[model samples]
Target: MGGTRVRTRYGRFGGALAAVVAVLATLAPVSPPAHAAPAPSVAPDPFFTYAGSTPLRELAPGTVLKTRTLPYRVAGVPLPLRVVQIVFRTTDQQGRAVAGVTSVIKPLTGTTSRVISYQSFYDSLDPEHGPSRAIAGSTAPGAMAAHVETVLMAAFLLRGYAIVMADTEGPTADFAAGPEYGRVTLDSIRAALRTPATGIAPAAKVGLVGYSGGAIATNWAAVLAPSYAPDVDRRLVGAAEGGVLVRPAANLRYVDGSRIWAGVIPMAVVGVARGFGIDLMPYLSDEGRRIYARLEKAPIIEVLGAYPGLTWADLTQPAYADPASIPAFVRTVNQLNLGTRPNPTVPMFIGQGTGGQLEGTRGDRPGLGKGDGVMLAGDVRSLARKYCAGGVDVVHREYPLSHFTSVPLWLPDAIAWLGARFAGRPAPDNCASIPAGNPLTPLAPAR
Candidate 1:
């Protein structure tokens, strides 16, 4: 939170990725409502009317319509900066908003691209646990928003694209975890369309970009889109996810030992434990519980460095000591098998950190024979091929960057590809033909 305000509103609670599960469980009341209560309006969003423009506007080229608030609601509090909408006027060799570009690009090929949003969560030490949603940046004034404005939104706006960042923590202030991400992402996109400024062609192409926790929303959206938003006229062109942090159990184990991941463990443990009504403080020595709570919302790397000699077994309770009452809770954890799911109707960009693997970390687990760190990029691609057997566009790209870098590098390309598909470009067999297990290496960055 101390760093420059480049953090995107989208990543306001990045630290909560570890703590959200625990926090949500503790905070959400029994029989809580589906959505969070509404928030009161505070300062007027500047982008609400840029240059006297609407949410959907014709702005001067290169003039970023800054800090436009997408109408969003969180339980009881109307977060002033839930989703940041930035509009870039397309330009030529010389910067210009490229008037009439909308019309020229219009009739939008009648292709539909709906949003498939994913949310990140702390690993479930217990398979029966639900995810946490402590709203990391939400409680911290301006911290959450700065992340979105500086990191995520600016990236998209600079590229002449519009961005919708969702504060998916929802109404109860209990983090709904993965499922909520997909719901909120899809809903937010719909909200964007309905917003006065979005002016998205009714059938405009929609693409998803998320990393770490975001991958949860993106992944679920891809799988659920066909069934959920079928009537929206979407082509479901593509999705790109990096540092997936899939296989919740395994991921939990991987980071437990590492100093890098240790900082956020308390938060993750509390989040996951809360789902099962398991409070870690009761289980651990008072000193341990206090240490865990203090480190709960911090980053993982910081955790491990602080407490040396930690392991997965030490942090988590025995699996299945008590059976789960809720079917959703069981499914969220035990059923989090990534390889079995099929690909969407479009191409996919899956990335992994050199140190991270589907098995959760760089170690070897029995069923996950491939070294834990072995990238799942290949596995996801293969799954896509099988699902789209007759025909599907599945491309796998692996970057040299670790989990964090993967998203930003491939995001623009994925968007461009989605744009081409929306423009009536054919889905490619080349993706299918690309050799299996080969990392879809990125093109060298332009000088």
Candidate 2:
């Protein structure tokens, strides 16, 4: 609650063998809904746009309700036949039936039957920000994130791997909602493998990859697979996530009063509230309400560096001097903590950036040792160790670069790691090599 805006650090590349190298500064960048093709000759998103009473609620989770052919765009223009969209029935975090979307991108050439799930880190509260809508829809604020993600996805495509992009945040766009993210992702993969029109094998190898916001979905899906989605889990080879936010509560402390990434605090607050039907207004000060209203529909680009030195003291009422002490906030954040969840069944490849001090501010926060601008690096290490202790095969890498700068360094590795998982070879683990990390402490049952 008293986080200070301190200097950031540098990170990325060759973790175990080398120290994190400080990278230079550059602040900066960060859904799905489908619209009709402008080309009069093309049809609308038939399945995604259809108004039918199929009773998605009655169907089992992961059931494919409808299918449609949507334009797979490179930037904003359409590239027909490359991507297929599916509307499926899935369950939410609370076990309620909900409808979700997933996009299946067929490769242009090459011959790998492997299919990979690329969870794009499009962190936003707007429904249009989902990958399903952004991949083919017109360019807007948050939709361009799909375009940026396409660069990494192209590598998998060129390697002949069909990619499945799920709206992990769900149709409701519940940002930071962990269980919902897992449910949507696993179910989307289920929809893709089961949908015959996509031409994917029902038993194809699968892997999950995500960074930053996307990592929330990827990590949860992996941890939830063994129990929540065993059918999908059996086929998953491994999961790779970078710049992961393992503990949301830890992250809140990590980002408070920061320079570039402090803006995410309000964005996360509104998201968790919308997802769980909680009212944060009661504890928030007038400034907090203003920040909430301003960021209600704003995208990641708007959230980055939006607020400089914005502390909880500035947003919440004097009575709520420590937001975590608020019962509802503590309970909800604990539910979102990845460390509280079970270990992943499949092998894992994790990369963390420990250069937040150089990236923006508040890197020297006492409890939040280091970070990658938006996520806490120490928390990532703790989660990785937790997985290893649970008998999971884990490979954790720490990058010595800031959040934005670490992208190029770990993305290619994530791709290659996923590739290895699909190759039928054994994975290497670093369980014995990892050092002890800070405990992932959850709020006590009572204050």
Candidate 3:
């Protein structure tokens, strides 16, 4: 379903949005008051914890847990912040801490603008296939957890913000897609609120941000907001998704023989099927099963070039031969193409980058609609207009950059847009009634 125009890798960190703040604090000398006694020497306790009988089940060994205070200046007014460590489970199945993979609690910060806001990030991981049926030494079970440490830590830290990246896929490395993703996202936010440091107002506001697979979580989080976490005082605010995979079925079809994604589809299939207890061998031919089983754990891009000897005609043959036998495949793909309707809880900010090719084809297409089918500017504009008409504050922007190039540019704007909502700004007008042209173009305020 996708192709990369540029190939650049990013790094992951263990709570280093910047250099260690405590270390910096220690290095800087402090002038004691004339009447003050000497400061006490203390040992460092990095684990962020609580003294309660009702223990949260997710906390595990080798995970670094700590609180981060986020301060942002708005119109010269200083804003106090609290980002507590709720719970972050490590991805190691040996029950040991794995380096560079973790999840934390993101808190609710009350806004001087009267809109309370909270944010979190979920990154993807890669699952591996081993020699035996009972695999061992697995670090993280799914792609959602695979490379997340690099993507999320870089994105959140640079913005002067802290995020709770929950390894919600559980200890078995289960990547709970769709509705399951929504549950974990909301529960983590709730857990963050319950942490003592958050100082949550009863009327605190909330919003979401995610990219690619993470966008799947963000989209469902927005849809489930009204029903699931109503007490959290959340509004959609705005959501900026990059290369969103909304239509799972369409994505599967596109990636079957597509360059750079051949491995991705099969990996997702085996991983998801295993998670759901579906056996794929019955649906695949002996040769098809053999190839899929071997390449299931391979990295996405690496898998594509492995089969170059095969023709496009060979790749599309399996799909055309049998459709009924792959019910799980059908269900999995169908989940990707979500329906069109406003979240009703808050406005949205949707965006797409021109860097990745969708459906194994590339071109500048207008009137491209939202969901997983196509990544066209025109469809995005049309969706933006619809959200605007329903009294949702919808803002759509297209950059000249590719998928990865636009992340840095999009992060700040996404954060600020949600920040405005947390500040209690009124949602912008509905776009449903707006003309298709310039749907994302900001209009002049009525005099």
Candidate 4:
């Protein structure tokens, strides 16, 4: 009788627990299995190619070459959202027509009237590492940056803002080629507006947002839009960027021998050569040549800190030790310098950091002053001041943070600033108080 009672009590308790679970299951449906399927291969996808009968040069910039829709995924895990990918014709750094790809992610609510051109800082020398591949479920190391950016993209999406992520590096992944980045970005927005699948109106008011490498694209797009794509420019609300690259030549000098950012020296070398179709191989030292060959197809993840204390002298032949001595480099970097370009017409919000020591980069460098590890804060200030002087509204902020850490602080303020712009608020400007910064003179070839 005792055993029977014990069994009966336990059975009743089990039945009650089962009933509770059933009710809870009804309230919250079960999600898909947590284990994601195998990631797609890292090999280049042929869909990126523009195989149409007409040459790319024959097509107008922003002309749509191809369009497809795919499920949005983050690091190989599929999300409920779907994204539209567009292949568009855009100009390269050398002014040649090239193919570019951009991914348009709509909010779950399906509102597409407001859009943000969220440039991805997926800095890589490999085209396969572009954002489109990551969105399509590739788990490659190079594509990881794009995968990580999906979280930030989701923030905009949650706010009922559609995000257009251009592979700003272009089809060839010309990392750090700022002009090409701008061209690709503007063209991507053009393509997104033209695509019916994206549901973005042709007259959608667009704002640009990016940090680090993305800032290169954001600022350039703003600068070039007035002439390169006036139709897109007129619709611009404003631009928000952090860690701006004002003058590439100064940056090259600033980051030389940096413990963390020195690797960017060779990456930029490879990217500039690829973007401009210039052959710099003859000027490289044997060690430089080996480093270049090894990093020709590397991503920024594999680069940072890989070559601590590397410098231009270490990378060039003895006679070409000074980068300015290389005629091609002088011409290319000057072209890449934001200071040489016309000021952007749109109101701008620029954020810069000055705590480079935290990232192993020294704060004291003659003429360069303090920087945010990779980008010089003073350079950013100079660019902002230049924009302000040109009658553009500018709001500049500085933080005692390194390049990576500054993002967390900059992002929230950037989003709020952009929101204010969209709401027709008067853009803010601190031009009168902005301190003088480093000179942004273009580099001249060494005599």
**Which prediction has the highest lDDT against the true structure?**
4
Per-prediction TM-score: 0.56, 0.88, 0.59, 0.90
**Model 4, runs deviating above 4 Å:** 1-41
| C-alpha local distance difference test of each model | 0.41, 0.77, 0.42, 0.86
Q: Give the TM-score of candidate 1.
A: 0.56
Candidate 1 Cα lDDT to native: 0.41
Question: Model 3, stretches more than 4 Å misplaced?
Answer: 1-102, 105-162, 168-176, 197-203, 233-238, 286-288, 294-325, 340-344, 355-390, 429-447
Report the Cα lDDT for residue 447, model 1.
Answer: 24
Clashing pairs in 4: none
lDDT of 4 at 378: 88
Instruction: Using TM-score, give the best candidate's number.
Output: 4
lDDT of 2 by residue, 257-361 (tens): 888778788888999998887889999999999889877866777777668788878889998878766899988998988877788889999998888888676
Report how far residue 410 has shifted in candidate 1, in Å. Answer: 3.4
Per-candidate count of clashing residue pairs (backbone under 3 Å): 52, 23, 40, 0
Worst 10 residues of 4 by lDDT: 27-36
Ranking by lDDT: 4, 2, 3, 1
Taking the tens digit of each residue's C-alpha lDDT, what string does model 1 give over 1-447?
Answer: 733443453355343322333333353212212243423434432332225344322543223333243322222233332333433332221112221101011111122233323233322222111111112112322123223322343333333344444443322112224443454455455544544444344554566666665666677566656654553326455776655544454444445554334334454555444433344454454445666655433322233235544554464344422224223334444534444444456566665545344323444443332322323444444444554563655655556544544555756665565556546676554454643542222112122
